[model samples]
Target: MPRYNMYYPDYEKLYPGIEKRPDILRVLRASDRKMRYMEKGLKLERSVWDRKKQTIASLPSREISLEELMEDGRQQFSNGPTLDEQVQHQEELRHLHQALCSLEREYQLLLYFRYWKDMSQEDVAKMLSLTQQAVSYRERYALQRLKDFVQNGEKKKF
Candidate 1:
C-alpha cells in the first residue's frame, strides 16, 4: 500500500487531498535526508532579500537607475500566468512554482538535475560532493517535504 515512482511535487499537485501511501513516504524521506543543504540555500536567499532592502533604504535619496526601474516594471508585468498552454501544462507550472517556493534549494536542484537535466545519481553525487547514497537520501527527503506541504496546504483549503 505504498506509493512507488511518485515524484513529490507531481503527487502533491495531483492529489492534494488524498493520503500518500507509506511506500511513497519512505522514498520521500530518503530524498529529504540527502538534500538538507537546501535549508541553507533558503536562508541565503532570505539574507539576500534583507540586504537588498537595506541597501535600497540607504539609497533613498539617490535617483533610481532607469534601467533598474524599467526592469522592475517589466518583472511585475510578466508575473502573471500566460494562457497559451494546455490546462495541464499550466497546472504543472503552477504546482512546480509553488513547490519551488516552498521547498529548499537542495530539493529544487535535485529535481532539476534529475528530471530536467536528465542526470544520473552517480553524476549528481559527484557534482554535489556527496556519496550516491547521500544524494538519494536527500532526494527522498525533499520529495517528502513537498508532499507533506502540498497535502497540508490542501487541507487548509476546505
Candidate 2:
C-alpha cells in the first residue's frame, strides 16, 4: 500500500514491519536517494545516446563516387577534437594519474585491476587473495580517497 512501490517493489516482503523501525526506514530513504540519483544519470545517458542516434540517422544517406570521397575526406574528418581539447584531456589524464599514484600500492593495484582491466570485484578478490567483502570495502575506500584528492585540487597527498 506504500506509494514507494514503484521505487521499492515488494517493500513489505523485503522489509517486514519497516514502518515500525526508524533505522530501517532511514536506510531505505538513503537507498531511495541513491536509486533516484542513478536513475537520473541513466536517463541523461540514454537521452544523449538517443540524440546521437537521431543525429546519425538524419545524415544524408546517398552514395558518393570515389572522386567525391577523395575530395571530401579531409573536410569530413575535420570535426574531431581540437588541439586545445586534446591538450586539456591529456592534462586531465595526467592529474588523474597523479591522484592514482598517491594511493597506497594495494589500492592502486585494486583500482587498476578493477577498472583498467575491467575485472569484476570477485575476480579482483581472487587475484588479490582477499575476501569479496574486503575487496569491496577497499575499493570504496580507495575511490573515496581519490575523490577527496581530486576535490582538494589534487594538492594533498593520500
Candidate 3:
C-alpha cells in the first residue's frame, strides 16, 4: 500500500492497527480527497490575493491635493448660468407669479407670508389669527391649486 503518512501526521495514532482493518483503504481514500479539496481552495484564494495585490500596486502612488480631490478632474468651474437658461428661469418665475396672482386674495396673502417672508406655519397662523392646522391645510390647498393651474396651462380658474 502506498504511504499516506506525509499527508496525515497522526495517521498511526488515529487509526491504530491499520494493516488489520478492512476499511483502511476507504479511510485513506477519504483523507486524500479531503486534502486535495482543501489544497484547491487554498490555491484559488492565493490566486485571488495575488491579482488584488497586482491591481493595487499598478495604481498611481502620488499624493492628491485637497483642492484637486474636491474638483474630481473637472477642467474649471462655470462662470454662471447661460443667457438662455437665465431667460427660461425668468419666464418660469413670471408664470409662477401669474399663477399666484390668479389665486384668491386670502391664498395669496397666506403664500406670501409663508414663502416670501419665510415664516413658519405657526408664525403665519399667529399673525393671521388662525389655527396652525388651518394654516397648514390652507398652504397645502393653495400649493395644489397653483400646481393645477400651472399644469393646466393656466386656463381654468380655481
Q: Give the number of the best model, judged by lDDT.
A: 2
Q: Write the per-residue lDDT of candidate 3 for residues 44-129, one digit (tens) a residue.
A: 22212256556432333344444555668654556699899999999999888889888888899999999889999999999999
Model 3 alpha-carbon drift over 4 Å, by segment:
1-78
The sequence of per-residue lDDT tens digits that candidate 1 reaches over residues 57-130 is 22243344445568677442455446665676877678756766776677788878977899998899999888
lDDT of 2 by residue, 22-123 (tens): 887778778987776555543222212356556532333344444456666634356689999999999989888889988989999999999999999999
Candidate 3 overall lDDT versus native: 0.76
Cα RMSD (Å) per model?
Answer: 31.3, 22.1, 15.1
**For candidate 1, what is the lDDT?**
0.63
Alpha-carbon runs more than 4 Å astray in model 2: 1-77
What lDDT would each prediction earn against the true structure? 0.63, 0.77, 0.76
Best by TM-score: 2
Question: Which should have the higher TM-score, number 2 or number 3?
Answer: 2
Pull out the clashing pairs in model 3. Answer: none
In model 1, what lDDT does residue 22 have? Answer: 62
Each prediction's number of clashing residue pairs? 14, 0, 0
List where candidate 1 sits over 4 angstroms from the true fold. 1-89, 154-158
